[model samples]
Target chain A: MSRALLRSVLELRPAVPRPIASPRILPATQIRALQTQTPRQFNPTAQFVDPQPRPSQLPEQSTSSLSSSSQREPPKQKPNPPRVRLPTTPPEITPQKLDPSVKSLLPLLAAQPAHYITIHIHGRPYLVTEGDAVRLPFLMPDVQPGDVLRLNRASTLGSRDFTLKGSPWVDERLFECRAVVTGTEQEPVRVMIKKKRRCRRKKHVFSQHRYTTLTISEVKVVTEVPEDA
Target chain B: MTIRGLPQISTGRNGVGAFILQCKRLDFHYCDWAGSSRGMNGFIKSLLPKFAAAHPQIEITVSPRPRKHPVVVGHYVNGKTKSIEVKNMEPMQVLQKVKLLRDASGEKDKRTTKPVTSINESVRGIWSPYHGNGMRV
Candidate 1:
């Protein structure tokens, strides 16, 4: 608040009081009073309580007049604690290595939301949406071509239009996205070996990447959601 | 087309069409801003375009996971992949890490290996979105 407005408010100066705007003055005064009482918790400056007329209403006379008027009308009380409408969380989905409790519920709660999970490969998070084509960074181990696979375990889940977000760990029970694995796509095998000549020690690192393609078929939310996404 | 120091959070159609690449049974190691150009962003930014170019029929978009969490926060692109993680490694080095994870969890079975337990009273805590403020997510 400017010093001029402070002086006017302290003096109870009624400036530009429109008929449609007079009622709002009461609530704004209440808010200001609350702010004065607890400046530490709340900001005492002008809040957007009334948007019609953006003028200060404090009188320019003396605070003594404002004090007498306040006395005439009994002091108003503030509202109690406000009810919060925060998002509710799914049950614990983390592994409690020491407690063992989190581990037990992990199977039941964490996987409840999704049947197929998009896994990240090569520093990339894959959609693995139903009917997705995935090429592994390297040849997969012991997997043949035309093999059916399901990718489960994802950090995120959402539809093209709608989305249900989980904190780093999205609630698993909220959704179920599944995919069918296709056959392997293999690159030519390559060899990279290291050896120490004097000791006759040769280490052979043979590499051949085989990736499995998946067809994601389903991605759906369990319950009805309001507009918020 | 590109994601920089900020997570490219989009529900745009291009990010979610058909064919999402997925890696299942993965133990998520990082969930910070997924597309922030610092580490993984540059890599994935390069990777997604190539895939889209090759498969012109399929539309592709990469966006952050719904709710932001440390354990799972990453990108969700089309029906293809859930995330791309560099972890401060080179492109090839990054590829090697993903390949290892894919090989380990190649089996189709995705059932959770964990057992069942109850929510104890002491553990009963609500997740407040804004530090125990108004929102809960």
Candidate 2:
């Protein structure tokens, strides 16, 4: 009877070991599951799991989330329209002669040290000297880095000694003005809380505008016949 | 609230605010003994001085071109020179030529087909075949 009692004690000891082993293994598995889930949420390369179904319907969902949120706003802000491609065709320009009296004075004007030009783009005037960096009011459509733009329409080209003014616009062939597109600049995001009277709902409107940046690469008076001539 | 100011510089329109004369100088060349320079010599002595005084901006020079016909050359700011033969012409005719040269822009004359020319983009954008409703056959 004592031998039977000893065997029963051994069996009871095995049951205790089993319960201890399970507790240790279970904690390790739970920790591993948590680690995997955390990475999935934070990893940029991980597959995107839609938290809400509405956003996934938009066309630009494949890219990063910043552009996706911009799309959800009102139609007034169209998804940054596809950049318009500038035509490769050259502008039609005709060389013009100055009145003899005006022509005679050009040498003295050109001899003056520095000059400034008032160039017009899209009917807006920008008075600048060479090497001036201008932040345009609107994003230039279809322009890219290193693209050279010839500014032909000008109101005036002047120096301290003399000013040459145009009736409406100075002949483009009279002056050689060029601008190089450096890149684009973005303004800081602005958040506006829109609240209606007698209503509890508050909508957050976010906007970030972008502008084209350009540098006045050159401004020179055309004293000689144009190369094309 | 949506409006934002864009920093831009005003562009210069050459003749919009002020006009600069393009003709910088005039040189009168005449032969003292040549019969062809008789009227030109008289004009230089009489009408030329008043014309020079009228246009202070223009630098005028009178020099003898030995044995050659009388000529007036206009120096333009465009690095071009226009010469007019005033041999045997009256002072009035020489004055007209001077006015013509002074008004010239120094560019070759071109036949303009369009009634009006502008740098502005067209208000109506170009039509694209890929866009808008497809034309029915």
Candidate 3:
């Protein structure tokens, strides 16, 4: 009876390897049945599993539940993409009414071909037409090659037949002028020798200045004027 | 028989229709053994790949020049070339030099007093005493 009790205790322990088969270990099959009835405590490959549900959709405890429950749920659809935004120039404030003479002659000027404009930059005037190249006296900062610059300040806009001269400055609504930054150019280096009378020492100073280059892309005069003007 | 040239009716101007970059190619030469080329070697290994990828139009070539200082040469579409010595320069400084070369117009430097240069004829005809209604003297 003591030997039978020892065999029952050995069957109760689950650590016994399954490969060992003996007539005394007939209770091992009963132990296998008990193991199949219990749920899995942990999964070693759970971290490497693909198609896992998003963390926001399920809690950690719910994720550990039976895999069959997850298969019964429907697949989630992807969210819609955001709309694209395009860059545009900001609109200017409400423009003032054009002078009666300007209103009448602007159409005539616009009809003529090959126009030129006197564009002012930093209070300096530069008379340029389309396809002309201008090298600014000072280095223009924060500008890159291929950038289009809209020149708004102008003192004069004229064609072959008619000329529109502004009173100090022209209204920007009448015409459009655009230029593209090409590159920068430097002047030849200059050397100035400083000397004093009866002094054996002389100092040499070298100076070079860089200038920004731009090509006039467009010089157009609007033909239509507001009826209210 | 007299030889004559073709009469040109139009001039070809850049940026009038399509814009083309002046810089076409860049050559980087570095000395592996010299201490002066240490920064250049680093720039070639680290920064050059990204720069070449960014400017696909510019053809870039890198090669070693033993026992000499590092030099960069830029070839332009106008058939002019500019070279800059980058010995003892940091990577960023060398990058700035390269940008300067890329932006150049490939023309010889000269002092210019006028801002605007145009080939187009003036909108208002030139003044002449021989033409138009005679002005009151």
Q: DockQ winner between 1 and 3, please give it.
A: 3
- Which lDDT tens digits does candidate 2 get at residues B57-137? 789999999999989998977799878898887554566567556554454443332312233232234667997788998
**Tens digits of per-residue lDDT for model 1, B18-121:** 32233333323433454332333433444334433433333333444432321212222222333334454533233334333332323332322221111212
lDDT of 3 by residue, A1-229 (tens): 5554344333222211110111111111101111121122333233234254332223222212211111222344356532222222335546778888888888889988889999887778999999999999987643445556678778999998788998877887788887777788989999999999999999999999889888887899977656765
TM-score of structure candidate 3: 0.71
Query: Model-by-model lDDT, in order?
Result: 0.35, 0.58, 0.68
> In candidate 1, what are the lDDT values of residues A104-183, reduced to their tens digit?
43345433433334444333565444333454444333222222332333566543223333345444444555433333
Q: Evaluated with TM-score, which candidate comes out highest? A: 3
- Candidate 1's C-alpha runs over 4 A off are A1-124, A138-152, A160-162, A191-207, A224-229, B1-137
Per-model DockQ: 0.02, 0.01, 0.23
Per-chain TM-score of chain B, candidate 3?
0.89
Worst 10 residues of 3 chain B by lDDT: B12-21
Instruction: Score candidate 3 by lDDT.
Output: 0.68
TM-score of 1: 0.25
Q: After superposition, how far is residue B68 of candidate 1 from its true place, in Å?
A: 63
Q: A-chain TM-score in candidate 3?
A: 0.58
- Each candidate structure's TM-score, on Cα atoms with residue i matched to residue i, is 0.25, 0.38, 0.71
